[model samples]
Target: MHEARSASVPVETRAADYLQAASMTAPLLGSGSQETPAVNTYNSACGELTVLLRSSEGGRLWNHPVTLTGNNSTYHLRLEPASHAVWTPNYFTSFELEQQIKEKLIRKENIHKGVGGALVGVRKVNPPEKFAPPRGITAAVTATLDFHGKDATLALRRPAKQPTATVEGKTRPLAANFSAPMSYYQPPGNLMFVGLLGGFNATKYPAPTGLYFMQPYDPDRIPLVFVHGLFSTPFTWVQTINGLQADPEIRKHYQFWIFAYPTGNPILYSALRLREELAKADQLYPNHKPYIVVGHSMGGMLTN
Candidate 1:
């Protein structure tokens, strides 16, 4: 019978090789700089993997989402020098774009596995000129994403010439009049749940106990205040806030507020405290419209 002929099998492809061979095109924004009299432009139009932008003085400028377009493939984009009430530019403006493909391209290769489905192909741009409206020629930039035989133009703009009207009135100052105490933002985890039966010891937890807000107050959106039950902190409503914020219509029509107090307090005392807080808030904000109050567990009796 002798030695049988050895079976020939092809080696399975690796993720790196599959990613490297991904069928996509990279346009003008790439890896090298071309200096000129007026502006310096960098081109990495081919084989571009990643790009990053950092302020010369290390300032973090906010970025805003404009839109996500295309089918079968999608592009995520952010505008440079995101206009903010606080953060200001110290140097040149920058923007970023990423490409994502939904359908699996290679066999046994999972894209964005364990990474929350984030897309790769990140492109960062730092225009040589400042973002302010024109003193010289406009800095033109183009972005394109192609996948599954579909091509999408991500962003194309002359930074100095695009109208600035879009950013106006989009948001308000979050830390000024509508700020909440630091503890409200940090949920106490299991301690919050255990505190219910712990009585007066519940007050010992580090988180503050009082009224709090999830976002800056807006006159246009009616406030929906939530009150938590015995042994519970305002943190209990975090998931509810998340769910509400996910619905664009709900988020647009309402602002979320939370009321936290020591569960050990008498229900009548808690109710009285809530009434006082409401009066104070109404006085400060001075709106003619009635407010919405929701409560859970013992807090529900107080609400009633």
Candidate 2:
């Protein structure tokens, strides 16, 4: 009779050991404060294993085309900071980075096994300073697998200098000034009204007052007026005003004015009213030159 041979350790147990060893050496490989090392299984045409990673520093969040090796699929991962800056408050606070990595792993696992899924187990390694005991600093690795799919995701949020506030049942970051902008207008009141009128006998006027002036004080340049069409307002030219103010070529030649009007009024009445307004401008600012009128849509028809 032959002596019974001692049984070897199971493949799964050996694999777990290899993973633990690799995780232990992860810190030695990178100098950054955040590190993520995760393993996932996929049965696509490519292969059965997939690994994803993101450094504490903002660089490549996902490392694709990763290959696995070893008897039980033990793999080593090493990452370098994308820039010289420390991977701290700049990109992601320590707490945010830790949370991100944990979530990433949990998502990966769910994509591997084809069964009912949820986060099963999670383990944290070395966390950042913000994450202490009560506010523990550590990495969380989670496993999730479901009948539909399996995957993991990681997230990190670090402790702040000033503890945040819980307001209206929601935690909000502390602000230097917690005041809302003051408003001059009150709602639910008709403090403003809209109207339109037309008269064929209205004087054919020129440009209006304050229509022209120099870059520093020129009198020859023509003033341009922009009239917006339906459902529009003076705010439309805000960007144009800013651009013209900055450009030496355009700024030296013209001054821009935008007209806002109610859209519900009849198009013909608005146009006739606009023509009368232009005549008045021409009469008031004779030195400014007859204004160059620009109108959009209905406004264009009126100006013509």
lDDT of 1 by residue, 39-98 (tens): 111112111211121221232311333222322223333433423211222222332222
- The runs of at least 3 residues in candidate 2 whose Cα sits more than 4 Å from the true structure, single-residue gaps closed, are 1-218
Error of 2 at 138 (Å): 57
Q: Cα RMSD (Å) per model?
A: 17.7, 24.3
User: Which pairs clash (backbone N, Cα, C closer than 3 Å) in model 1?
Assistant: 30-44, 31-44, 196-231
Q: Which candidate should be chosen as best, given lDDT against the real structure? A: 1
Candidates' C-alpha lDDT: 0.38, 0.30
TM-scores of the candidates are 0.43, 0.29
Candidate 2 per-residue lDDT over residues 1-304, each given as its tens digit: 0011112643323323333333333223221122223211111100101111232123232333222233433433222222211112123222221212222111122111111111111112354221111222222111111111111211111111122322213443221110000010011122122112111211221112112111111254566777755544433443444445444355445655445455455667667667665666556555765567777766587677
Instruction: Give candidate 1 misplaced runs (Cα > 4 Å).
Output: 1-184, 192-194, 197-205
- For model 1, what is the alpha-carbon lDDT of residue 295? 95
